[model samples]
Target: MTFYTYGYLTTHHNTWQYARIGLLIALLVVFIGLFVHYLRNRWNVKYKDLSIITGVLLLLVLGLQINSLVSLQSATKQSGEISATVQQAAKHLKVSPSSLSINSTSVSDNLLIKSSQGYYRLDYNTDGSAFILEKVTLENPKIKLVKE
Candidate 1:
């Protein structure tokens, strides 16, 4: 899946971020409480089992936090790359990037930009390190590309 889709899956907005962190903290508190109770009732078999379960849960929460951090980093990087590419393409077309609307599919590496001048599609390389103009459909016949 693309970074955009993955990010959406994990978090939709700032509120979700706060909510997720809050939930994680609550889980940590619960685990700590369970562990302390287990220690106070060390002789009970049930407390021993509960303590082990709490330990496992703590590990799971730690893993989830790590994964969330990685995902956020990746999403930020991918967003920057996409913005840069769009700006470069807009410059080439002699238009403001803000004037163009982007349309991308989750399964496709290509991105489509629609502007008043025409429709342009950009296709990325297999490794996604670079992209090139794949196609253009101009709205005006008077507009022409100058050969350099």
Candidate 2:
């Protein structure tokens, strides 16, 4: 998870945003109730001490909630960027590109490349150009493209 964060942004594993919120609210309610009970039952305990504890707990909870929200938002934004880049690559590869004979690369087994249109391998070396295509063999064996 940390490695992925360092490179590609992934969505938070917790898809249950509502559940997380509910759990946090429940914990806050329980903590407050317990603190109140402790204060009411313990005459020796100072109210000032309880107030301090409550303030600290509230701060901690708020910090946690904010962090979770920020992390979730960041993951979403990064994932969107990655997806957009992949789509752009696909679009460019589908555009007119020079094709050659079948290659030995693993990506060649499932796709066929043509100068104008064909299934394109995602791992082609495009040299940062608009797109690149490599020859691939399909199961049907009927795939054919004329070299331009």
Candidate 3:
């Protein structure tokens, strides 16, 4: 809810918006309630083997989900930590927010912002610091900007 609210307050750039994770959490809560009831002998179970298989599968799915979620959250947090850096870079470059574009570098702790001048790679290691690098983008490689 807070994430959604924050997105609403800021920009809705994330298309997924993590709705799948929310749905998975709701399903997990319901499953846990039913499983608890079954364990307490309050729920009727006609297919014990099927239930066991389903529980195991759910656990596997949950484990995979946890792993992915942790990685994604860390990446998101790392990028998020440099939001102010991006804004300041934009102001320094005299670029408007609409024209400024920000991206993250997985290879390093850097937040990259592309502008007409070049790329501004912000490095905030608990210190006020940033740097820029120039790159000549060719229009012939439009696909490169989109995807590989």
TM-score of predicted structure 2 = 0.41
Q: Between prediction 2 and prediction 3, which has the larger lDDT?
A: 3
Model 3 global lDDT (CA atoms, 0 to 1)? 0.52
Q: Is candidate 1 or candidate 2 better by TM-score?
A: 1
lDDT tens per residue, model 2, 86-111: 44544555531122222111122232
Output the worst ten-in-a-row residue range by lDDT, candidate 1. Answer: 1-10
Which lDDT tens digits does candidate 1 get at residues 3-122? 222223223334555667777788778777877887888777686777677778778877877788787777666655666666677788888766655553132465766666766778
What is the C-alpha lDDT profile of model 3 across 114-140, one tens digit per residue? 565765555554544545543444343
Judged by lDDT against the true structure, how good is candidate 2? 0.47
Q: Is candidate 1 or candidate 2 better by lDDT?
A: 1
Worst 10 residues of 2 by lDDT: 1-10
TM-score of each: 0.59, 0.41, 0.53
Off by over 4 Å in 2: 1-23, 35-55, 93-148
How many angstroms is residue 122 displaced in model 1 relative to the true structure, after the best TM-score fit?
Answer: 3.0
Number of the top-ranking candidate, with lDDT as the measure: 1
For the record, the alpha-carbon RMSD of candidate 3 to the native fold, in angstroms, is 7.5
